[model samples]
Target: MSGRQAVPSVRGKPGWLRRLDPLTKGIWLLCTGLAVMLTLSLTAQLLWYLVVLILAGTGAGWRLKQWRLFALWAMGFGLPLLLFQWLMLPVGGDEPLWQPFGSGGPALTASALELSAALTLRSMTLFASSIVYATTTEPRDVVVALTQQLRMPDKLAYAAAVALRFVPLLLAEAEQIRRAERLRRLTPVRGVGGRLQSARRMALAIVRSALRHVQDVSTAMEAKRFGSARARTHWRRVAISPAGWLFAAASIGAAAATLVYF
Candidate 1:
């Protein structure tokens, strides 16, 4: 199988960022993530989105594909802003811009548009930042940084890594199985029978594949002497560079400025 797992080939430390520890990268991601989540300022949100969008091009190409998916997602989520602006405005405000209904309506003011823009930008930044971080950094590194630097529980970290790794594998495997089913069924179109039965088969296949993977990982771990008693070493090492430090500093500075100004 072209898709069969031999081993995961995660990229190594770039010459540019080999000096800083994983903890620093982790810290930068955390702080940026917090800013993405908590900030109400539009400028800060746009800055974070732009930084992460550029960073997305640096890593595995798979992560960049999420931008397409996120556009649809963000628009779907952002639609509520229009509704909120329509419903909540004109109730008490002096300035009114949009009147949706004849007379049973509220007014849409500039303030309402500003609030909507802020909320929408914040939501989009949060979504893009999350995808960028996940795509640029390996899940294992994230878990390791949490456990080693933040004193997160070892079991929790391990579980998180496994789950993240499992998602893409399962998705790929499901795609393969779906193709196989299509081939098996001699049809120009996917009928209800084909869709339902194929979905059921894919679910079972996913479960079996997951269980097998778990068993294999356990066996390999035991063979390598990994246990509750022994220290586990990661093959993929994540280190930050001077550029990463500058990036973090800029992100923090932006957040600070936004906080001070707002």
Candidate 2:
């Protein structure tokens, strides 16, 4: 055998949505979130969420399995919140849909139900948009966009990039620590108090690991003279494609229309 490493094959072609610039996607996410927040009409909320669902589906290459996962997540997150909103909203007027206690007690009305549905849709729209941005945009691209396009300080941009890079690592490290503890056949903790104690142990271990990782990163950055200068050059450029600009314009326009019309 030759001393060569095999390159991994690329999967399916990246969709148009993924090809768009990270800044464009960020704009879309912001517009969608703002629209969700500004609109109280159920119809407007539904339309905004539908647009986000379409974008997410396109980004995922319209895979049925991915759509199923999105639906499952939407239902899981929205249903409980919807129920709680419907129960707690002090919306008066309209006929009571159902009175859990007595007639004199708090009652669910049509307006309350409508408002709850709108609120649930708003939450789901924001959640789905956030997932799209997080999954499609690379951390390095975010740093480039911030420093080069937005004219942000290199120190702040690099700090944001480091946070994005470290969060997943920290989570994986915590999982590994749990697995190592299990492999050692540690005493099984039971009951609420035992669970709290286990969590405390895990938290301490994670904190120590995080501190070590931070120190190593800081040392490396210092050796490289990172943030020593006011200006920096990137190895690669992140340019905004025509399609990305068009997408951003359309998203902003739709958000404006939704705000004004509904």
Candidate 3:
């Protein structure tokens, strides 16, 4: 099979990043997420916001396709932050409006409420940024970067990449099955029982679909000489550019400064 054109890879650009290595982008996102969470000053949070701006401007914002997904995550992480701000901060001070609930006889001030609002925004922003990372990155790219650059074993890395590739495919298939189930007159749930029944159907569909896709992918990979130690070549290789290192260094430096200060 000398010079046989290999099966086209689902790697490289996703019609979005235009050949931007997913691994590079993933590391940058990781750094940004860590920095945002640790940053006490909202100004610092805003600075990292520029990274997201650049990503969007470059058309890589296709990862942000699932903005609605962020709402659920925002509730999970941001709600707690809001609750933290509410319980810890007093609602009154010089401009006291009401009294603290128990123990301390301090007045709850408007300033404390204002602080909560800011904290809420910070939490939501952090969560939203995280969603962008998960949505944008294709797992195979990450595995390649780790294996090729970090000297990790290709066998292990490829295993990880294959696993990631199946997640979204399974999700899509499960969604399809759910619709099919609905068409079978088992959907459009109105009561608690109906909802529970729908959930059960969806869960079963996901499991079955995932198993089938796994088998298909495994067979296809095996047929294609994947996991071979015969030195397969990449037609489209991931190259680390000078820009990548610069981005990484700046992210690390910025994150470090924030942690030390705030």
The most accurate candidate by TM-score is: 2
Worst 10 residues of 1 by lDDT: 4-13
Runs in model 1 with CA error above 4 Å?
A: 1-25, 57-66, 80-92, 147-151, 166-227, 233-237
Q: 159-249 in candidate 1: lDDT tens per residue?
A: 7777667655665576567667767877654688866876687899989988999999788867966546545555665555676678668
How does each model score on TM-score?
A: 0.61, 0.74, 0.59
lDDT of 2 by residue, 26-73 (tens): 899889889889879999999888887777666635345345545766
User: What is the TM-score of candidate 3?
Assistant: 0.59
| Predicted candidate 3 versus true structure: per-residue lDDT over 174-259, tens digit per residue | 54665577678843679988788888978887887778878887899889877777454544457767776676677678678878
Cα RMSDs, all models = 6.3, 6.2, 7.9
Which residue pairs show backbone clashes in model 1? 17-241, 90-107
Write out the backbone clash pairs for model 2.
none
Q: What TM-score should be assigned to candidate 1?
A: 0.61
For model 1 the local lDDT of residue 187 reads 65
Query: What lDDT score goes with residue 209 in model 1?
Result: 84
For model 2 the TM-score comes to 0.74
State model 2's lDDT.
0.76
